[model samples]
Target: MAQLGSDLDATRAWSKARWRSELRAARRGVPASVRFAEAMALSNQLTSGRIVRPGQTLCGYVPVGSEPGSAQMLDDVADFGVRVLLPVVAGRGPLDWAWYAGPDSLRPGPYGLLEPIGERLSTTALRIADLVLVPALGVDRTGVRLGQGAGHYDQSLPLTAPGTPLVAVIRDQELVPELPAEPHDVRVTAVITPHRGLIRFD
Candidate 1:
């Protein structure tokens, strides 16, 4: 029985890897002009949709590489009168948090990501977020978020308050009907896509 369980885990991981590579290729195929426009659209929607109220803290991140949204989008979230806490990759465990001061405050961190220069908060600090914006490769209509496969958000999201929205940010095409799932996967409550805006699931 244990061997069977291990085999299933290996198969699921392979499926997720294939999906990740395919989605990455799709993102890379997008024209630079269109990508920029989509990023702007995402920023407009997230800030205007009132996901985070004034004075509330938002657990968010700075989009890197071919990811949806941009660093400016994070700034826009901050400008919406909410405090933004960007993740700091710590080893291979759950992520840490830090206040996003501005463009000047970001310093390079682990996993080739940018992190804030402010005081690093522990994983439990996620409970302070009114809304959590998680990065993903794609998300199914069922809210099974296909992340970058690093499992960072997987470990980090459980620290949030039960009622806080665990939202996935992706491009319009990345929202699919279904994706491979594992028991440990943290499903998102909602998804934000460029043209699709924000779509919620039960």
Candidate 2:
């Protein structure tokens, strides 16, 4: 984790909030066609990159609202015969998981999230995932992900087995040179963007 002073920490927090607003606005402003194109591009990149083998388990989430992804992206990944688990927001604690049967299998979850309507599994399910694709407003080159202040992923990601590829799915512009960081924050090992495909951090 990057060291920081008290004043620097405060500044970074404020900066994160500002960046969140700016990025949200930018996403909202994107044309529907452009968003769809980008989403499909992301799906193709994942499928073609062979990030997860056919038998590997993958943990992914359904992109909701202006989240910079489409339901088709998750569906396409699952089509590879890989077991895809969707996040279940059981409470404020670590996120649970349920098998992604299909898009129709999803129901409205808390905070407008789309969760699977199947047998729910615990966070330990994450330990088996060969790859984890998490949502992010932005990600720095150093792998520090700028997430929603909720800290759900930050807390839950620690349960994963060491060296699991935790990838943050974001737009090309969302990849930055630097961002705010804290000691407790769990950094992403890689980032996948529409055009850039996957960029891994050492």
Off by over 4 Å in 1: 1-14
The residue pairs that clash in candidate 2, if any, are none
lDDT tens string, model 1, 61-177?
A: 998889989999988888888899999988889999989999999988876789999998898999999999999998877899988888889999999998899999998777766
Residue 198 error for model 2, in Å?
Answer: 0.4
Worst 10 residues of 1 by lDDT: 1-10
lDDT of 1 at 41: 94
**RMSD to the native, candidate 2?**
4.8
Error of 2 at 61 (Å): 0.1
Per residue, candidate 2 scores C-alpha lDDT tens digits across 43-137 of 88888846777788889999988787899887788887778999998778999998999878999988888999999888889998899999999
CA RMSD of all predictions: 6.0, 4.8
Local error of candidate 1 at residue 30 (angstroms): 0.8
lDDT for 133 (candidate 2): 92
User: Which ten residues in a row are the worst by lDDT in model 2?
Assistant: 1-10
